[model samples]
Target chain A: MPKIVNHEERKRKVAEACWRVIQKKGIEQATVREIAKEAKMSVGSMRHYFSSQKDLFIFSMQLVMDHVHERIKKLPLSGPPIKDAMQVLSQVLPIDAERRLEMEVWFLFTSKALNDPDLKKKSDEMDDELYQACRLIIEHLTVAADWKQETERLYALVDGLAVHAIMRPGRLHPDLLLSVLENHLKVIGQNV
Target chain B: MPKIVNHEERKRKVAEACWRVIQKKGIEQATVREIAKEAKMSVGSMRHYFSSQKDLFIFSMQLVMDHVHERIKKLPLSGPPIKDAMQVLSQVLPIDAERRLEMEVWFLFTSKALNDPDLKKKSDEMDDELYQACRLIIEHLTVAADWKQETERLYALVDGLAVHAIMRPGRLHPDLLLSVLENHLKVIGQNV
Candidate 1:
């Protein structure tokens, strides 16, 4: 009997390989050949899944967003309010090497989107998703205070925290990042 | 008599032209030829100032950091502390087209620095400069109770504000950005 491989799963594996190449050696190095080599497949096979370079690029970025969504879905949501909120937010930060790679690729794709129109659409959608998450966190806290003001403050802080984690991981230690986040929760008078 | 052109000034102008090209077009479009065209000179003349493409790229990036430093230096320090801090900090944010261009180019250069060893040295130096500025601001607030902690908080907030202003200009409006910065300074126990 021959081993069976899922086409969709193999496509995802190729995208993941592209991401690793991008994280380790800028996006410029994420050529079809390199990604194919990393995936342990031939360039011809990779091209069978992706018709063009743009297709692979977009799919790779979409795969990144999907991974983030998957991780967020896995977090234990049924917990104490404060702890749960922190956990949900921490899923977005680079607390571990995997998330760090995800963010590195995220940042690279974002810049690349500036030049590629198709990628720009997906990038915009992801931005909205992030803002929506922030809005949800704000609304949850607004039961105690002004939704408008608290929403603005919380969103800024969350955005700040995420970017700091990516830019200066050493200075913005995850524990310290969590403490400041917890402080904001207290300031907003959230029951958490 | 032939016009006496300042060699150093001409080189800076060429670097600035290179930045405009990179920010408007993608970095890949920022070729020596395009930069020369943007600067209204022949490629050979531009070469008189820069020996290679790499030199132009490095100088253009350094020019951005230098410009940011010059702007910060020009800000008047003898004013209401809150107002002065706001003024200085706002200079770093993408409030207008010029600074937006600067932010875009700064981000591009940062990504390039991750893989380019030569650029890495300059990036590390600038990173320290950014960190030192935060440290200085914290030290200045030492008269306040728990100023050490206050500094850390404000530093994170500023970093967050800077990134937000660049990544989501429309979402994080200039006024709101300034308001958050002001409120943060207040929390630092600064009297202004």
Candidate 2:
């Protein structure tokens, strides 16, 4: 049998290579050649998947979002509502080594997006979706509450927790993260 | 009287020049030559204040922390505890253009500090101080409560709010930031 080529899978391999390069070196050095080397492929092969660094970055950045959404979709919603909610929220925090890396890369990409228009547009749209997700969770659990204010507060809390947990994981311990989140739910008197 | 040449004041002026360069161009472009041009000083004169970009960045970064501390120190703390706390917290958020610019510069400098040992040490210390400030406010507002956890939550909330408000001021809105802070205070049941 002849060897089969999987274009989608190959492109994803390239994107993962991009992530590894970004992790090992800083974003400043995430050049196409370096990424190709990281992926263990020729620069010519990388050109087939991504013509430019911007295209590669957009795909890699999008991969981060897709990964997050995939986890959310796989969440066990059959558990107790508050527990399920906490579990869902914890998925977004850097509670483990793998998550911490993703969060770090996310921040770097977001910062880079500050100067790149296409990335900025995508970042803004993604943030709006996250804000909406925050609002929906609050709506499901709270009654007679100011959903708007709560959404802002919860969004900020999650964002802040992710940042500290990613940057100072030693201090912002994972168990501590869960408990603080649970405490927030208790404080808000979220319905069980 | 001889013209009084204030070395300390002049150094700050140079730091501010660095900020303008960072803001106008970026942290990467904030070279000594560019900063000197921005400061309207000759490169030879600029060398007198900062031996290298590292020295200049350390000073510039410290100046940002000092500015925040100075503002917090000047806050009127005699009002109701929650209101007073919100006021103190508000100083950290970017409600206006100037503070927003400061926050952007702070993020860039902090990111740059990640690979630089001296800046990393200083960044960690500054972050610890800020975390301590968060603990103090939580302790002040509540009696016999879990100040440690609340401090983490509050710190995260404030930091998250500031990042969003600075980056997406048009959407986050100044009033929304205030109300979100107020809502967090109310959730903790600071006062009736």
lDDT by residue (tens digit), candidate 1, A23-117: 87888788889899999999998898889988988998898888888988988787766667787777667778887888778878887777667
Clashing pairs in 2: none
Residue range with the least summed lDDT across 10 consecutive positions in model 2 chain B: B183-192
The fnat of each candidate, in order, is 0.36, 0.59
List the candidates' TM-scores in order.
Answer: 0.89, 0.90
Least lDDT summed over 10 consecutive residues: which range in candidate 1 chain B? B144-153
In the predicted model 1, the residue pairs found to clash are none
Q: lDDT of all predictions, in order shown?
A: 0.76, 0.80
Q: Could you tell me the lDDT of residue B5 within candidate 1?
A: 93
Interface RMSD of 2: 3.0
Measured over all alpha carbons after superposition, the RMSD of each candidate to the real structure, in angstroms, is 3.1, 2.9
Considering chain A alone, report the TM-score of candidate 2 relative to the true chain A: 0.92
Report lDDT (Cα) of residue B185, candidate 2.
Answer: 78
